[model samples]
Target: MIEESEKGWLLDNGLVAYALRVGEDGVLEHLHFGGSLGSLAGFSAWPRQAYRSLQIDDRGKPFRHLGTLAQELPFFGRGDFRSPAIAAPGLDELVFESARKIEGGLDLGDLPSARFEGAETLQIRTVSRHMGLEVVLSLTLWPGHPVLARTVTVRNISDRPHLLDRASSLSIDLPQADRHIVHLTGSWAREMHLQRHRIETGRFSFGSCRGTSSAQHPPFIALTDTDTTELHGEVLGGALVYSGNHETVVEKDEFGAVRLQMGLPGGMRWPLAPGEAFIAPQALLLHTDRGLGGMSHGWHDFVRERLLPERREPYRPVYLNTWESAYFEVDEDKVEKLARAAKKLGCEMLVLDDGWFKGRRDDHTSLGDWQADPKRFSRGMGELARRVTAEGLKFGLWFEPEMVSRESDLYREHPDWIIGADRDRPGEGRNQLTLDLSRPEVEAHIESVVASMLREADISYVKWDMNRFVSDLDDAKRAHLYMLALYRIVRKLRKAFPGVVFENCASGGNRFDFGMLCLFDQTWTSDLCDPEGRLDIQSGASHFFPLSALASYIGPSPNHQNGRISSFEARRDVAFFCGSRGFSLSAEELEAHASSVKETAGLYTSTQSLVTKGRFDRLRTGAEIIWQLTSPSGDEVVILYARKRSEPNPPFASVRLRNLEKGSAYRMEGSGELWRAESLMVAGLPMPHTDHRANPPLMKALPTGDMATALLRLRRV
Candidate 1:
């Protein structure tokens, strides 16, 4: 135990700020403050027992009495002072250590050596009220790394037990927050009105998150008036509040941003027994200035160029998959047959989905063996890869690297490898255990597996799948630490297979977020492949993505995830309008719809640039309508019109096309209708107006003008 005076720190405001060398760099590593002290007991920080012995009082004060643990701090004075003559500097560089407390008084614990030896400082402060607490804290800049972090600390200075009725409050500064886009839990928040005084809130709905405004009128604010039960169908709690003026913004002008965490420390039923404390994690990210202009416009540009730069221009996957059509009885012959068919159909790639491993007929076993199953491919993966490449198509494979079936050799060898409360507790996700990425052995195994497969075959694409979420994370209490370990694993895989394209698929889009996107090139948007179902998913995703980065691969009409039969025209329109467009249907299914399939393929190739790499514009949408997407150059515009029910199109449904140069020469290709750029820009389009309003119940809004609308607009010098 150390004293405040000895530690050279002070506690004043409703927050804490400190200065210390966190790691290799002399950068200020971390700063922590705020949250009721009682909640700190629930956390699992370093020197576990060090905090266990401290005493806390009814006023939420922390103190230490003697050698042994106590429920209350020994009384000193009205305003007592304590300090150690000699102590550790840069304590935050590593774990908390038991050093020569000013006077060599108490033992902290066996702490690791600090990574950096530098002057360090600590401070804790806060202002608390019955309702909640307000906090503002800062730590000196260390300049060690691109970002800095701090561990939450709770000291119990009091003797009585307390119950915290609420969660703690954490806030982070968004210096670039003004320009950069931010997406939290499936909704995007744009800068609406940044005022001088108070932080006003705005709303963005889930399915309607693309443009500056959401489809819903009341709009979707990051935080709500009350606890929201409709957030992605989960009873989610918490609100996102903002402060600072919009006019005086920070963008390429700022260097770093501050982050804050405000929430009730867990187990807040503060019956916080005297000697306990709780701590939570603070997650943040700092980025370079690209398109900070909300909706990830600038961010996506960077992502395409930096994060996923292996492929030349976005390689929209025109793929042939074996999941739905071929489940268990897939063999070399079947794969070759499919690849040939896929090539004939002009598909760019061929993917062997599952059941191509030794002793792996079912989902119950053989995940550890990444090698091709002899029975499925007698010639092996290398031979198969060469054959596929010979047919002028790329080869892709699937792997659930994070999971292991109980019957598998890996799990049988190391039963303890799976994460669980105890050895007896059953693991989850198809009776499998999550490979602990924290374990160096697990990470090495993943690396070995990836290396072996990449080396064995001429594989160009990989669909990385994580089928489930973690429930019991016992290795450590801090969830972010575990997440950090997982991220490291991804980095290892990516570093090893730099040439192989990796697609993130978390049981089909449940874990879809910017964090994951930052690592993998493309993400399987959703398992929901029905064209209609995808509209919602794609709309929500496009809020913060470039259409080129989105994996808009078309699957079978009656998708495995959702049973909805949609026309090939609609599917191609939606899929090609985004990044990669492909199909997962069987050769027979596609062959049966031969003419339509060919047309769809041709359409994708014709408008690949406009759809995959074009500037987007939201035309119009409301309760039961949506018409959007246009090219950067005014050459073409792809529009879709749909009605809620088969209702007569009401009056005039006007959609204003954006990004048109007013004074340029323009001509509509369909009717050979020559119109000036100014005229088209002003009048917009009265699409299908005649057929839409003919009858009330039978009337439907359909796309007009041409199968493909191309308008030539001359660029102004």
Candidate 2:
């Protein structure tokens, strides 16, 4: 709810509060953004003192107003040394011209953004008449969520056109400084590694210029105090709902105040014609005084409830993917054998990874051709799909719809469909080029090809893959337009194939963002499936995304990627916490571990409710990691994993569980031991001293080895 007062505007969403006011010179000033503020009565009295201390000099002379003022929508050329949220060539300066409240949330044409349902919105319009541009800032607050969604729209109001250099979806000023900045950064095989640093006096930022949301930096940023931890201190987090080139900036001014800005990266100048408008990406802001974990829970709930598609609560299927199992050697007979083995081990689906298309023997060719290869499958794709389904398993296919191999027939026929400069040939990655989805003809061709495949076969799932990054686009706007067109295609495909589940992958988690998450059921966490590396990868991803949106599968023991041999128990334990569980092993390979595979499948079936729908908590100290999932009604389960061997005289450490009802007695699933939640939380459960002998039993003590993992289940009594 938004309430107006003599001081400024106060927006509340039951869990968090946002307040701002107009300064004497008509500038929209930021006041407070954090925990809930009960009433607006004392809010007005605090801004004056806060601004004065942050601005005034010791000699009683006031510094430049632009440098001191914490404007909500700051512009360039206004003496403000900080980065401008919106910048244009001629009209780099802007002032607050008008402000008012609005009814529905703003729209971004065909782009995917967070929808505000039954929420209050405030629209503040600022104009630079000399430059003939008008900027509209909309801030929306939902009823029960602590998140605020912000978007900016720029209109060329004058008779001439305007070139937009930079425009951000959201920007805010924090009154204090010396806060810690936390973000995710990594590369292809290893993605989303959490890194924290102290906010210094200069600018610190990270972004993607590779066209796709590159793994170099994810679209997430957070600020917290030095004392912040998983369960304590205040944290403010923001993420963009964009999968294209984006930037997040943190600037600390001379006065020790900090400004956080997130928007489209510079260098792409969008030409806005007279009366036409350009809408920036949406930025979702979350605030929590209960620390990083609280912020994570809020983001998880927001994504699952608001960002994902409708009816997203259904159980995610456990399947077997043929990527690592078969790779480019997959054929009708091989897939049939894998499907039968998958069914024997309780897999509900079988996904033919790649090399199923015509003339496709390797990744170097046959990406655009969506038909089954007659040489490999003489019986036809429809027959193979039916045979797989007859074995009581759903059939899925892999497609790199956005890419085409130069060796493929489609690329030879339609070379104009690729995004490239007229003068220069585009550089190739993975022996492929990107299809220009921004073009209507290209989009239509992809839609028809994919639609025909789904129609020809009884396919129930698709592993959508984009193997290479986009490059050599002549137009600067092509990157943004590409993302817009991709969203449109995915939206139409979902409508056409409502029953088919889509898993988004870009050589593993490169395109991981809220925008794609809204269109697909889950994402491939990473291409590197070594159980050891995945522990960190999944942990960093879970900070912003829910476990249900992450896909974890047990791959070969001597992992195909890194050749790191891991125990089946370690791999299965880690995969169980992921939302969509699967295996990447062949039928012949599965026989050696058939009993273990069956036991793990049974465990996944029994714990599906807890892992998918329950709240998740993490407890980590050094090489030991513990993840807990608790239902809303208090049933809980925990997974403990130790990466390294213990010391010669290891200290006895207890693992404490979180999110349990205190004073309530809970029964352990295997041992039938009853313990009060209060005692369990306070004293923690002791690590077992010896290995257990049961088939699927909990560990008696912390296992010591290169790879070790244990599972514990509990129910309130």
Highest lDDT scorer? 2
Shift in Å, residue 474, candidate 2: 5.9
Candidate lDDT values, in order: 0.46, 0.82
lDDT of 1 by residue, 58-84 (tens): 233343211111101111221211211
Q: Candidate 2's error at 54, in angstroms? A: 16
- Report the number of clashing residue pairs per model: 67, 2
Residue 553's C-alpha lDDT in candidate 2? 86
lDDT of 1: 0.46
| Model 2 segments more than 4 A misplaced | 44-64, 421-423, 690-704
Stretch of 10 with least lDDT, candidate 1 = 241-250
Question: What CA root-mean-square deviation does each model show from the true structure?
Answer: 14.2, 2.9
lDDT of 2 by residue, 338-396 (tens): 98899989888888988888999887898888889999998888999999999998888
